[model samples]
Target chain A: MLNIAVIEDDKYYRKDIAGHLSRFGKVDEGKSLSDAITLFDARKYDIVFIDLNLSGKMEGLDVIKEAVKRKIPPIVITGYTSEKLVSRAYQLGCKHYYNKLDIQNSFEEQMAPFLRSLVYKQEDDIFSNSFVTRNNILIKNIKLVTEQMFLKNNKVFITGEKGVGKTTIAKFIHKFSTGSMDSFIHVDIPTLENNMIEPLLFGYKKGAFAGASDDFKGLIKQADKGTLFLDEISSLPPSLQKKIIKVVEDKQFYPLGSDQLIKSDFRFITSTNENVEGLIESERLRPDFYFMAKDVELIIPPLRERVEDVRPLVDHYINKSGTSLLVSNDSLKLLENYRWHDNVRELKKLIHSFCNCNTEMISLINLPEHVIENTIPSGQSTPLASVYTKGISNFIKKHGLKKLIETIEIESFKEFYEKNHFHYMNTLEELHISRTAGYRIKANIKKLDKERHLVH
Target chain B: MFTDKEKLLHDLNGNIVRLGSIFNILNKIENSKDQEISKNEMNQMLEDAEQTAILLNNDIKTFISINMNN
Candidate 1:
């Protein structure tokens, strides 16, 4: 069963939602903004249904902002519709937003798709052999349709650069659906020998070919009642694509050299790092196969975008090596900033290299010359004032230095305070600011901290 | 071009329907006899409608105040 939470001020609406959703999960209610904050902090619910306009001037946005930082997708329910509110909420990383007017009529029916996606899934799988990540958005996107994939027999198409764990996601879908890693047939299209592709996929009858002594069940048949994942799908031969079309549509096919039609019901998941349009236009990939696999598409972001995962990945590798080694903050910073062209594969390779080092802690000195050269130095930073060179010059040209200085005051204070070890008294004394000035700066810092979702 | 008054009334009506009053309307109709609408369902809908009405009234007050200023 799923754990669900609701944040709505209206008693009647609250009860309606609670009662309706109780069928799927235990309904926990929080009416006010404070309750919402507490609800988020105390227990991590699988899904949160939030009324977009909860009493205090769209306080729902505030709740959503908090939820996003926690990496929980908020299902926004509201009557007061605004493009601005929707855009802002999405910018803050809200995934599902629904209009109350439309949904209320058939609450259960309207939300069945999202609600039925209640398979037991963790955003991270750190405890298992496969790694977990803080990349909740990617995980949630896949999770949002996991139930539908199994229940409705929909195929999943995953697109990501090599080493971004497309196979891992495919396995996650099957594992969570079945609660085990069984009968997951993975065919790496690019790695398979060109001649072996046909015989391996659609197994041949006994004496079908020169070496065929016994009837071999195809990969498709092996994946019956399980998931069949085709990795690097663009590499699949055109001839195979034409032959597999029948299996894709009817879930039945003829084994090579056998007239008997075999029925194999398997969940299909295909992945490619290449652009689909390019593949289609160039005729490398057939459009029919692409469309069939593309019903529920998931795009995984590269490592550089998910900077939060860097330190954990580094730690995992170090711990796995059993060397009791650690990565220095500086080295981790450099690693986080580097453009991972090869994605996680590149990161794992780099981590493996670091494990071979003699030092207890892998620091900047231990990094490969090429790796260090490619990365931005952890200690160096470009001055913020120099950032809008053209715009700033124009602003100063038209307005003056006074307004520009005023604009950078908060930044200046932050820099000064940080330089003084973020100690208010020392920073104030060093800056020679009055007590009132210090108080205002401290207040602003608190405001900034809240805005950054550092404190609930 | 909807007038401010028209939009407000429309929004109010929409909320009223969404508050589960649509079920009540259905129950009143002869064709809706098939639905075994219970007292609990009716009560829940009425309670929700009443609270939303109050909230909507407050918002209308704010909108009227802003319009008066303009």
Candidate 2:
């Protein structure tokens, strides 16, 4: 049974929430922020319902932030909500923010399914398998390569850092390939013992060796008329790598202790987290094998390099987790700035760990200490700053540098005047310029403002 | 013209009543198994109710600010 928490300052509302939720699962009621915190710390709750203001104090938002950090998805039910407050709630990571006046009816109709999803989803398989991205050029290129490669039956060579979704993409290509069925077989090269590698890849005849008492069909034969995905291809023995290249070239291999050549038709999809050049130079990977494997080479970019995919991925994971908790913009900004060494796999685990926190929203405060420690702060040259820079660059491209500089000067002067409440002396003092220059800048700002008004 | 405290209070009470009745309608819609209201229509209704609640809340906040300053 799911454990749920309801935190509201209003006694009547608190009871109402508890009563409604109790029908679905165990309900823990809190009439204050302190109660909510204490209850949350005592045991794990699947979901938390929160109010922005509790007893005339907005400290409840803090409690919500904390809960979201812990991964407990929270729904905010409050009578006091404005455009600013709603946006703030989402930015802080609340799953759903509701006006208490409409919440009673909406809760049963809309929120029950959301609540059920949070508590009942047992697997992470619901997330969309297709690439989730905005404008990561590398991801777009890789996708184009996948589409290009899918047209032919050529062996695919995928390379990326561990957890960069190499296997996922391989599987996607397999499914997308024409005539794909239940015939997709995956073999982890590193897991097999050195002695078993040959026998596993190329079957063995009955009494092939002391342990080979019966005939065994290998992974290659099993993958006949389908796709064979070799994960961690870097771990394949050098001897076997040479042999497999021949089999891929001719689609024929001899079983152990047998003279008969086995002919099989299988599409090859191989992936590795190792640097191929380094492996080949070290003699761990045969050069001939590498040549045969690179029929269509696709490199999956690491998470940090593909930052555009993070927001959509976060949304995908959140939705797949079946939780109502919203991710705050601040948290997303931090996530985007983070160097995800483990890539999408690490991100999936991180989201899973925090989704258990019972809160209205996931805030920066809810983020992992390591993630928070590694992130670039807001005051720095952020991702948003780059977007603004691009916008400015576009303007400069369309217009000219001189016009851009003039506009910047006017805008800066206007900002300074506004900051000082239109006090000329204060603006001059801050700008460290003469009164005349300050007056001239102010006059320019007024003209620009008038022009802007006319354009609007 | 600025509304007097008495008029503001009256308006707030009326808004609350109106909001309560809307809630009642919403409750009936939710409880009915054969809900003829389309999802988009229901969403529109909810959005409308939320806007009214927000306007009322803003007015109350304005009144509180005014009284506090006074």
Candidate 3:
């Protein structure tokens, strides 16, 4: 039975709801908004039936707002059926709006469907397929594709930048594959570089190598009837790549220091940050292997494109790290606007730093000066303009010169100097400046540095 | 502010207790299988399981809401 809370000011209607709902489950009754809040805090209620027309200093809308703030969906039971109130109730996150006049008959009917929808909605909202993290639209898209691939027997090739979530995606595919979960095996090809490929793919007898002490089962044999995720597939040497192709296509490989051939069946999943097509063009990657694995190639997008997902990704990192670091809105805005060149790995490191600082909130002051300083044009020129102005002020404070006298016109010179720090000569060879002005500026900077040092 | 860890632990304990009670009832019914059990007994076992499941579901929902909000 669902634990329910009935919040109504009217004595008769409140009694009626409690009496009716008690038949379904345990019912907690509250006469006022404060009482409702207290009951909600004290107990875990599945559904909250709140009267929108509560008579008192406290309004029912306040209770609804509190519930919404707590991320709990409230059901509004009101005598007032105004369109304004209904729309407002929805805005306040009320999942069900019911007229109290028909509480006896229609209440259960309305609540039945609402509760069912709530369960499904909660599940959908929690585990959304469209959810992106750290602007990594590629990972989100890969997640969806991998889910689809899990149901079918298909070759999936994951490619992305190094330290991108390629390995994570490969593991996700293994975990979610339709095949038995225990059958999935992750094999790092780079680790097999020193060993003979055949022995790694097929089980080796004792003393197969100089130091072979015991017989070993290969990854392909162990991954039979499941997935064998090959990480850093590009690192496989040409000879190993050809052997891998043969194993993938012919389903057979010979063990090292042996002549007998062994057969095994396993689905192949490969990951590489490098461009396999480029490797094939360079004749480093075998054409047969590339063609065999080219059926479902998923190119993971970099993190810069999907800046909107940074907050939740940061939250996820913070949660996983068990850190109580709260990211301030402004600081989060800075993070979201940054061009995360290193993708999720870099963002995770930032979170680690924030956690290590042990600050309650990650403010702009706590962030690395460069991160806060380099706010990319987040499509909002006004904010960037303000930041630029602030940066110029800081620069001016550091450099105590009103303006540098230069050969170029003063107005254009100031703009160029403020923007590019007199680097126009580097960009344009003929853009001349007075040597005396440059010397004067250099002398002023040295003087300012000396003064700063003395003050510190 | 209550930490999410505390709330989750409290909810988990409550669910474990509820599920344990249902399991006990199921165990009792299985033990008494040799003696023809009445329909009412079977119905009670099913009802207990259903109630426990609902309680567990409610606890899970609460835990999720608390964690997400935090």
Top candidate (DockQ) = 1
Q: Identify the runs in model 1 with alpha carbons over 4 angstroms from their true place.
A: A1-130, A357-359, A376-456, B1-70
**Candidate 1 clash pair list:** none
Please, what are the lDDT tens digits per residue for candidate 2 over residues A392-429? 77867865787666656665665677789778798879
- Rank order (by DockQ, best first): 1, 2, 3
For candidate 3 chain A, which ten residues in a row score worst on lDDT? A403-412
List the TM-score for candidate 3's chain B.
0.58
TM-score of decoy 3:
0.49
CAPRI accuracy category, model 1: incorrect
The residue-by-residue lDDT of candidate 3 on B1-70, one tens digit each, is: 2255654653455345445544544454567654355799678657766876887788788878877998
- Encode model 3's per-residue lDDT on A1-456: one tens digit a residue: 345788877554565566556544457788788898898787666678887656633378888987777766688876555576788889888887876654544656765565646544533443454233433455456545654564345788878886567776666555444322347788777777556655777778888888667787788888877778887777777787777887888887876766787787777788887777788888767788777776688777666556766887888889888977788889888898875656777788889877877878888777865465445656643323434455656645654335222111333333455467456454232336565655554566466446433522
* lDDT against true structure, model 3: 0.66
TM-score of chain B of 2: 0.66
- Put down candidate 1 lDDT per residue, A194-282, tens digits, no spaces: 88788889899999989899999999999987778888988888778877777888989889899999898888889999888889999
By TM-score, the best candidate is 1
Q: How many Å off is the CA of B6 in candidate 3?
A: 58
lDDT of 2: 0.72
> Which candidate model has the greater lDDT, 2 or 3?
2
